[model samples]
Target chain A: MDFKLKIWRQKNRDDRGRFVDYEVKNVSPDASFLEMLDILNVDLVKRGEEPVAFDHDCREGICGSCGLVVNGRSHGPGRGIATCELRMRGFKGGETIVAEPWRAKSFPILKDLIVDRTALDRIIAAGGYISSKTGAVPEANSIQVPKPAAEEAMDAASCIGCGACVAACPNSSAMLFVAAKVSHLALLPQGKVERKERVLKMIEQMDKEGFGNCSNNYACEAECPKKISVTHIARLNREFILAEIS
Target chain B: MNKFTALYRSSVGKKIIMSLSGLFLCTFLVVHVVINLFLFKQDGGETYNRYSEFMSSNPFIRTIEIVLFAGLIAHVISGTLVWLKNRASRPVAYEMYQLKDNTTFTSRTPMLTASASLVGFFLVIHLRTFWVPNRFWETAPQSNYDLVAAAFSDPVYSLFYIVALVFLAFHLRHGFQSGFQTLGLSDKQYKWLIDSVAVIFWLFIPLMFAAMPAYFLWFK
Candidate 1:
């Protein structure tokens, strides 16, 4: 496959960015999207040009690092699939693909396609965990958490904190991300200990980080690579209410 | 803190005021419609005049009037704040928005139409005839029927009021459910039902109100 690419390029966080065009010829349809980008980067480096910088680790789609707004959809045209997992065969030959970083006030660009997603990590660090005692492991059967509750917690815990939700949301809201972390922890007996403080602290942290409010648009779920449910958001709302009331 | 500041401080704090104010306005609309329905009664003169006098003179109703005015101000302002926030968040406009794919027209149009109707020229006329005389001037104007009939007698006035009511219906359709959601009255099962009922009632009722004025102007 031969493809034309219009990719966003910025020298630094301070520089105003614009789309720069490139063409890659003789690309394999079986190659992943990132693999094609790798081919382009290799060609650029061979020609003594600065390579396009994008974050990626564990391209198996677990690390949640490789993400870009491809053709106005986050993580590319495929539903519930990351950019790393998206194969080049999805596109036709001689196609022009537009790629850009997630345009958001909170996720500032560090370089071309590389955004500082430390804000998401900060939200997690605020209170995305249970305060378990640092000691020898307790007997697993001691707590005896209900199977349904454990299953629900595991489901909510699947969030990889990719910031795709923020990218997809028209409001640029981080509600899904915040809600996922909150819901996962709030459902467990271990998490129930700090439920009140966790919700209050995390919400305060989220607000302090300059993320926007949820518009209930559900675009996040549509674009999420993990297909994380919006039920997490409802659970977060419930937690926020209970925290405030108690 | 002041009344406005007190209402703006917290999430629950803001929404509690919004719900109370919205519910009050909802009550006001129902009562207003009921009073207007009296005009359709056989003894239009006596019923309209007596209802008007009862509304004006009753001490509890007078207290409720003061609160209603406050509620209107609070609801509009808080709702506007939410609207502005929602608008600011979505700074980029789509090529075209299809409501069916995303949200209801009632959900999107209220803050928009309400803002327009609140500030528009016809609303000024509405205030001059209904609000200003009733509230500030302390004038015992003609019967409510006469006032409504006179306003609707002009085709332009009738059209404008009908348009405003259409907007109001759009406002109420979403307002009812949004109010319930914000007030934490929404549960998973009942939530969709509440939203559906809100859409039906507001859409139907406002059309009914508009029809009365439209009928009197065109036919009577």
Candidate 2:
């Protein structure tokens, strides 16, 4: 298969970016989207041209390091899979695929397809952690978490912190990401010590980061690579309200 | 900032105000629809006129009107601010923006503010026609029913009413559950019920309101 790619190219964060057209020929249908990009970069290098720059760590979707809005979708055509998981088979032969970096005020474009996502890390740093002193590895069963609560917490814990939610959101809201972090800890017994303070500080950080507010669009959940639920956002709302009242 | 100021300044705080004001307006819609139903009584607007007279003349109802006005102002102002801020958050636009899965027309559009603005325009004409005349202008039409009936008799006015109600319905459809969501009432347990009620409220109330003009213009 072959694809005509219109990829956003930026020399650096300070450079004004523009879309550059490139062609990848003899691409394997089984190749992941990132692998196809790698083939294109190899071609560009052989031609003595600057290769397109994109971020990737684990080709597997878990690291949340790889992201590009392929043909106007966050992690490409399919939900619940990162860009590294998307296959070339998803597109037709000789199709023109447009790839761009995540567009958000908080997430600035650093290069061709990589945007700085440290704003998310800052939000997590604000309060996405439990602060228990680590003396030894404690027995997991001592806290006695209920089955349902544990399951719910684990579900919320699945967010990979990719900014797809922000990119896909019409408002560029990071509510889903923040909500996942807030709910994962709020639902667990181990995280209850600073639950009130956790939600408050995290939300304050989220606001300060210049992310938009959730307008109940549900695009975040729809486009989430991890398929995180918007219900977590509702739970976050509940937690914030409870924190305020308390 | 103090907690109160912080709450008022935050996005969530503005949303809470919108929710509360929207819920109040939703309640007012129910009452408005109920009273408007008196139009279909077939008493040549006698029953409807009497109800309107009592509602307009009652001191308690008048005070509630003030509250209703305040709620409208708050909902509109806060919603506008949130919309502007949300727009500003994304300084850049996607070249090929596509709606992802589960996104509805109502969800993507500025249905609340846009429809509210349309409804607000209709409200101005409605007030000039019915409210202003009925309240302050002593020499205006004696019966509220006659005024409404005459207005609906004009095809353009009736069509405008019907169209305005449709926009109001779209606004309410999104607004109802959104209000509850902002208030933290959209829990796993009650979300189904709240969504069901919202569907019914948006559909049923607007249909009922639209039926009044339909009845006066065509059915009668």
Candidate 3:
């Protein structure tokens, strides 16, 4: 298969970026999207041209290091999978795929299709951790959690911290990402100790990071690589209210 | 900033205000629709005029009217602020984007709020025509029914009312469910119920309201 690619290219954060078209021939249908990019980069390097730059670490979807708005979708067309998981078979032989970095005020483009995502890390740093003093490894069964509560907590914990929710959202709201972290901790008994403070600080950080408000659009959930539910956002709202009242 | 002020300044806080005020306004719509339904009674508008008079004269209902106006103002202000902030959050626009899978027409269009805001202009026209004359101005008209009938009989005013009601319907379709979600009332257990009620409210109320102008313009 072959594809004509219109990929956003930039030298640095301050550089004015624009889309540049290139053609790739003889792509394997089984090759992942990132692997196809690897082939393109190799071809570019052999031709003594600057290779297209994109972020990817784990070819597996779990690391959340890889992302691209492939043909106008965050992490390509499929649901519940990252960009690295998208295969060339998803496109036809003569398709023209457009790729770009996450377009948000907070996520500045560092290079071609690579936006700085440290804003998300800053939000997490605000209150995403439980402050438990570590002395020894505690027994796993010692702090028995209810089945439902544990399940809900795990579900919320499924978020891989990818910025796809922001990339896909019209308003660039990070509510789903923040909500995932907030709800993951809020649902657990261990996390309930600082739930009020946690929600407050995390939300404050989220606002300070210049993310938009959630209006129940459900775009984040749809484009989420992890398929994180918007119900977590509801829980985050409940938690924020409880935090405010208390 | 103080915690209260800080909370109100946050995105989630603005959303809470929007939901609370929007839900308050929805209640007012239900009451308004019920009162206006009296227009359909073929009794020469006696029942409708009496009801309108009672609504104006009664102190309790009058006090609630003040709250209703406050709710309207809050909804408009918070909604605008939120919209502006959301726009600023995405300074760069996508060249090629498609939202067919994840979003509904109402959900995707940020202009729904603008449509609702346009209803504000219609509200001013409506109030000047009906509310002002009915409430304060004695020389304008003696009966509330006569005033409403006279206004609705005008093609221009009736057309505006019908158009505004259509926008209001689109606003309510998204606003109803959005209000529940923002208020944390959309739990998994009752999400279906909330969604169903939103669909009914958005569809039924606006159509019923539109029917009033249509009725007076043609049927009556």
Candidate 4:
């Protein structure tokens, strides 16, 4: 399949970026979006022209490395998958695909489709962990976690910190991402020890990073590659309230 | 004092204030709507004026008026501050974006907040026409329902009301569910229940209020 791609291009972090259009002929319909970009880069290299730059690691949806806003929808119009998982067949042949980096005050664009997502890492570093030292792996049953709570924790844990929630949010809010991290740890027995402080500290870090507040737009939930529920956000709010009051 | 300052200073803390004040104001809207319903009685202005009189005179109601104004001020200030911070979060706008693909009308439209600002303007006008004069400034500002009937007699006056009520409806549509979500009261399990209740606030309340103006203009 042939496709026209309008990709954001910047020489470096200092260069003002602009959309540069490129056409790839005779591309495989089943190639993943990143793989299609690989094909385009190969062509650009052969022609001695600069190639588009984007972040990708595993080429799978799980690494949270691949981030792109394809045709205005984060993660390329597909529900519950990242840009790397998007297939060329989803678009009609000869269609134009617009790809851009995540735009937020915290996640500054490095070049092309790459954004600095270290702000998310800082939020995790703030208090997104169980502080107790565990020298050995404890017995799973000894923790006494209920099945429902365990499942919910795992659900929240599925968030990959891809920055799509912030990208999709009209306000550029990282609330959903922070909510996922907060809920993931808050629901477990091991995490309950620092629940109050964890929420307070992580939220303070999130605010300090300058992400916007959630307006209940639910775009973050919708564009989430993991399809993390916004209910976790409500839990985050509840935890923050409990933490603040105490 | 440190904790108190932190509560209002943080983003999440400000939102907590916004939700509480917003929900409190929603309750006031309900009471106001119910009192307006008395206007539908065939006894003319008698029943409406009676409730209005009690609302203006009762010591409890009078005392709560201070709290009501406080809540309004908190809601407006926190909301505006939050909005300014949110705008700053996105310094560079997306060159090409379609939020409509992912979000619902009320959810996506920044217009919802704009509508709320218009509703705020209408609130000032409403108080000037009714509340302040009837209660404080005037020696005799025509009896409540009679004054309302007289105001609605003007086509432009009633039309302005209908327009403002439209904005109020749009504001409440997003406000009710958004408040619940912010307060951590709406979860996946009970989101439908909250949304269902929101229909009464967003739908029933504004429609009932709009009906008053329409009744005075067309039916009465």
Candidate 5:
């Protein structure tokens, strides 16, 4: 198959970005989107042009580094799948694919589709963990976490920190990301001691990092590769309210 | 108050404000439309003109009018702030992509259509007839009815009013359910019911108002 790509390119954070169109031909339908980009980069190298810069560690999609707004959706048109897992078969032959960086103030464009997603790391660092001593490991059965709570916390914990939520959010809010982190620890008994401080600090950090407020549009959930429910946002709100009282 | 500030600081605060203000406005529409229906008087011995006169003289109702303007100002100002803040939250992605149909069209386009309705008719025709003349309330209610008829006589005025009502129908449809959601009333079990009711209210109220002018101008 063949595709025409209008890919966003920029030299640095301050540089004005624009789309540079390129055509890739004879691509395999089974290849991942990143693999297709690799093929295109190979062509660019052969012609003595600068290779397109993008981030991808685990091409299997778990790393969450490979995100793009393909044809105007995070991680392309696939559901519950990351960009690395998205394949060429999703598009028809000779289709013109538009690829751009996520448009969020918090995720500034670094260079050529690469964005600074350090804001997410800052939120996680705020209080996304269980605050405990690093001594001997406690027995697993010591804390009696309800089966449902544990399961739900595990589900919330599944967020891969891909920044897709921010990308898809109309307000560029990181509420989904913050909510996921807050819910993950807040739902478990082990983290309950610090749950109040956890949510408060996380939200403060999110806002300080320049993330926008949630618009309740649910666009973030729709585009999230993990399909993180907005219900977590409700959980986050509840936690925040309780924290304020405390 | 600090707690309130926290709530206001978050997205839910803005949403709550939008929803509450929207619901308030929705109630205003119902009552306003119902009152306007009185203008459909058949010119009997006692009619809408009397109702209008009663409303004009009531001091209690005048106080309510002040509250109504306050609500309008809060609703519009807060709504615009939230909308603009939401807009700036994320930069627009590539514009060529199609939007999903999941959210109501009216919810997405409230400001657009609402502005059109306000600008096209409400600012000029409505103020002129209802607001400009101090007599809107001063004259015994019959003059208000006469003014309504006078305004509806021009096809342009009538057409713009009808167009504005159509937009209000669109606004109210999403505004109703969305308002409930921000008030924390959105639950899975009653979501569909809420949606259906909203659609009905939106359509029925606006149609009732539009029917008044269309009927009065064309028939009576």
Candidate 6:
């Protein structure tokens, strides 16, 4: 198969980037999106041209590293999948695909199709962890987590720290990601100890990061690869209110 | 910043203010629409003027009026802040963003749509045409219906009012459920019910409002 790819290219953070279109021919239908990029990069290298750069690791959608706004939707088209999981068969042979980096004020472009996503790490570092006594591993039955709470916590925990939620957001808000972490831990008994300060500090840090606020458009939910529910956002709001009042 | 200042400055805090003030304004629309319906009574605006008189003179209602304005102010302030900050969050524009693929068409941003810029503009003109003349200019209760009918008489202003009501429908279409989502009450169970009820406020209120002007302009 053959396709036209409009790829973004930049030297570094200070450089102004633009979309440079290229045509790739004779690609396998079964290749993942990243593998297709690899084929293009090999061709570019053979021709003594700079290859397009993007982040990817597991190629299995679990790493949360590979991200792109393909044809306008984050993580390519459809729902519940990452860019790495996108297959060439999803597109027509002669399709013109526009691949752009995640655009957010906080996530600056480090190179072509690569963004500085450390801001997300800073948000997680703010309070996404629970403090527990370091000792022998406790018995599994000791925690006594309820079934519903466990399900909620597990669901929230599925978030892979991917910034697709941010990329897909109209406001570029990280509320969905922050809410996922907040709700996940807040539901567990172990996460209850620092619930109040945790949410407060995390939100303060999120504000300092210069990301936008949630307009409740649910675009983040729509674009999320894990299909992270917006219900966690509601939980985050409830948690914030309870923490403020109590 | 102090605790309250910090809270108010945060995005979540500002949204809390937006939701509360927006819903307050939404409630005000209901009361205003329901009362305005009295204009259609066959008694030639007698009942409409009576309620209008009571609303104007009663100290309690007047006090509530002040609170209502306060809510509007708060809502506008937070909305403006959200729009400004969110605008700053995306300095670079996308070369090809098919927003329709991912999100609904109702103002992709909140304040840009639901939070009121057009509706606010219509409101200033609306109050100048009717409320100001009725309240401060000494247009007595007897002339109240005359005030409304006379204003709706102008084709341009009447058309503008109706156009603005359409935008209000677009506004509330997102605002009603959005307010619930912001309040953290957006449980899956509540969403179906909240969304169902939301259609009424977003549609009914505006249709009822637009009907008045459309009625007076063409039929009356």
Best by DockQ: 4
Better of 5 and 6 by lDDT: 6
lDDT of 3 by residue, A86-203 (tens): 9999899989999989999989899988999999999999999899985699999988889998898899898999899999998899999999999999888789999999888988
lDDT of 6 by residue, B1-220 (tens): 6767877988888898899998898889889999999988889899998999888889998999999999999998998898899989989978887777766677476435553779999989988887887778753554788888988989998999988988888888888888898889989988899988898899988999999999889988
Please give me the total number of clashing residue pairs in predicted model 5.
Answer: 1
Predictions' DockQ, in order: 0.24, 0.69, 0.77, 0.81, 0.33, 0.77
Give the range of the ten consecutive residues with the poorest summed lDDT in model 3 chain B: B108-117
User: Which lDDT value does model 6 have at B167?
Assistant: 86
Q: How far is candidate 4 from the true structure (C-alpha RMSD, Å)?
A: 1.1
Q: Decide which is better by TM-score, 4 or 5.
A: 4
User: Native-vs-model 3 lDDT?
Assistant: 0.89
- DockQ for candidate 4, C-alpha atoms: 0.81
Q: Model 5 Cα displacement at B126 (Å)? A: 3.0
The residue pairs found clashing in candidate 5 are: A171-B89
lDDT of 5 by residue, A108-223 (tens): 89999899999899888989888687479888888788998888888888899999888766567888888888888888877888998888888878877767775465777787
Q: With candidate 3 superimposed using the best TM-score fit, by how many Å does residue A73's alpha carbon deviate from the native?
A: 0.9
Q: DockQ of candidate 1?
A: 0.24
True contacts kept of each: 0.08, 0.55, 0.72, 0.78, 0.29, 0.76
Which candidate would rank higher by TM-score, 1 or 4?
A: 4
| TM-score (all chains, Cα) for each model | 0.84, 0.97, 0.98, 0.98, 0.85, 0.97
Candidate 3: lDDT of A202?
A: 88
Q: Encode model 1's per-residue lDDT on B1-220: one tens digit a residue.
A: 6644533544334555676798778778778777777766767557876887788879999999899878878876765565555455434332222223334555544454553455345547777887666666655567666777777889987887888787777667666765665554665678779867776557766777788778779877
Instruction: Please report, as a residue range, the 10-residue window in candidate 4 chain B with the lowest summed lDDT.
Output: B104-113
lDDT of 4: 0.90
lDDT tens digits, residue span B1-220, model 2: 7887777787887888888998998899888889989888878889898899899989999999999999999988988888888988888788767864658766665665678789889989988998899889968646888888888999999999999999988888878887887777787788889988897688999899889888878876
Indicate the DockQ of the complex predicted as candidate 5.
Answer: 0.33
